[model samples]
Target: MPIFRPYDTPRDGAPVLAAGGVSRRRLPLNFSEEDLPLFEDALEAAIPQTRLLELEDVGVSPEGMLFKDWRILPESFSSPSIMEQFLDRRRSVLKFLAANYLLRRRRKFGRDCLWIVDDWSAGYFHWLADALSRLYVARDAAKDLVLLLPHRYRQLEFVQSSLKAFAVGSVEYAGAGEVYFCRKLFMPSHVAPSGNYNEEVVRGLREMLVGFYGREGAGSGAGERVYLSRGRAPKRKVSNEGELLDTLREFDFRVVHFEDHPFEEQVRIAAGARVLVSNHGAGLTNILFMNPGGRVLELRRRDERERNWFFNLASATGLEYFYQLCDPENPDEGPHTANLIVDPQLFRENIRLMLAG
Candidate 1:
């Protein structure tokens, strides 16, 4: 039996591609002065430097767990702390042991390969902001390497369209329940922490995707006003969405259900939006495609203050960030997944202020 290390051995000489810096969140227009202390840390945070390293004889599990020399790599998990907790739980030790030792059936890639797939790669927001951001950072290095992804992602339209947009040359997928052994793995450090973002890398991603999908003179007007609807989702819906939709219509906001459209259409819609309104959800991730100086008004649950993913995104992409806290229809359902009950009057006031600026 072998023990797992939270991270790989420090590669002090790893190539640093992008330098880290401070990222500041622009407070919402109607932000309360009394709550400033609640968001002080997230208001300004340090971004980590991006690095590219080469690892030999690395083994990757189906969930994108990376291990070499009996030590797990931090890149396999969302963060090192999460890896520590995973080890604490001891739930996957037998599987890990089997994959590294007794698992005789393994797929071998005998070339310089790039591994950007992670546990969260299936989600749209993480796919764009996390996985693709790594690919963008390793664009030059990946030219000659085979990009490895999970087989399940092969059929996702956004995944295919985005890879095509990036013009990634070589790609191969590792099957489920199979351990992959790469002779030489070219791994790029995450562009930034989970919620924190790196301005340069994010802006670079936006420019690349927008260039691929943006049409001439499209989204160039005062810009399209958009309201993203989460009506199809099982939870976290706007309980008073009908009244809000009426208000949104008054402002000429186009109601968009992102799932109804294709990936390219979503990109175009995002590129054209000068103003975007949505409850806190993955749909807001499209802000990455909007032009700089655009505005976003997020409807948040009053108790859910710490999840600042969209706020950090807006800051990174130069979008005006605004928010209105609403009460939860089912407070017992918890903050992240609770349905929101918004006051139409407050929403109107916030919209007016957002548009005026």
Candidate 2:
């Protein structure tokens, strides 16, 4: 790695070129581990000499987790910084990611292919969309643009939105200029297995699993559920960690609190759990990798919403699903007990049904 200067999109200090004018702009290729196996396979089959950079390694997220708490990017591309400062100590994780991948596009492998994997849901969508837009803009001289997204149907919908945007229009930010989108080379598929994953990736995942289990052992239930809600952010926004914690406490069964874990970790955690529950959120896409006979419960906001994603995932993995309703009376308004929102009595009954099968 030559440690080139970071790509200054905001033009904080140095001179930057215009998009349609061309002065040398940065292009990012983002993907995720959930899409790894399929992405790698497709890339190798299509362009095997391509180099890869884990967005986490270089520092980026699909939903812009790195940009949280700031308004540097527009709302669609906006994100909450994943990094948290504990007791005013160290910079958060997102800061580290931004610093590392900011402007340094390293040359790895032999090809010019730069593979970026989005570990956080919705975090990488804007980046992927913007990069595609750039490629499309530079189409006269642009090289091939390849994108790998999770193959599952749920994830496909998000990718589809970006691709549609690329084919039709570009999204513009105040300082960042217009981002073009292209449907042709922006391939969305399943995750391909890694051939050269670092020791840290493996070790960290294991530690995460251990930590998850440790929490499970200490909690009321011996199980974990990855709650998937719609969009990248939670619809019913609660204030502070205490309110969310209070929401989780309302459920009667022993449930491990699993929020904002990476897609890979979600799979690892779901596989180890006896039951998995989600609210038709994007994270439910990970259920495709859950253990056979693993249980799933979905809480839908409305009755008519389509969940072919859930159906396909549950069918493929053989995980049982128990769909329940969010108490209309509670209406997810204000701060109410989790039990009232979910109706603990009904939730327990559904869990019983899942266990029965």
Q: Candidate 2 has what TM-score?
A: 0.36
Provide the TM-score for each candidate, comma-separated: 0.95, 0.36
- For TM-score, the strongest prediction is 1
Q: What Cα-based lDDT does every candidate model obtain?
A: 0.83, 0.34
Q: Could you tell me the lDDT of residue 155 within candidate 2?
A: 46
The TM-score of candidate 1 is 0.95
The alpha-carbon lDDT assigned to residue 44 of candidate 2 equals 19
What is the per-residue lDDT of model 1 for residues 1-357, given as tens digits with 9 covering 90 to 100?
346445455668999978899887768667888767546678888888888988888887766778877767778877767777877766576567666657746888798889886777788988998999999988888888899887788888889888877756698877887888999998888888887788999899889988888842473563389999998998888988998877898999989999998888899888988899999988899999988998999988886667889988998999988988889998788876898998999999999998897
For model 2, the superposed segments whose C-alpha errors exceed 4 Å read: 1-254, 260-264, 327-340
Model 1: weakest 10-residue lDDT segment is 214-223
Model 1 C-alpha lDDT versus the unseen true structure: 0.83
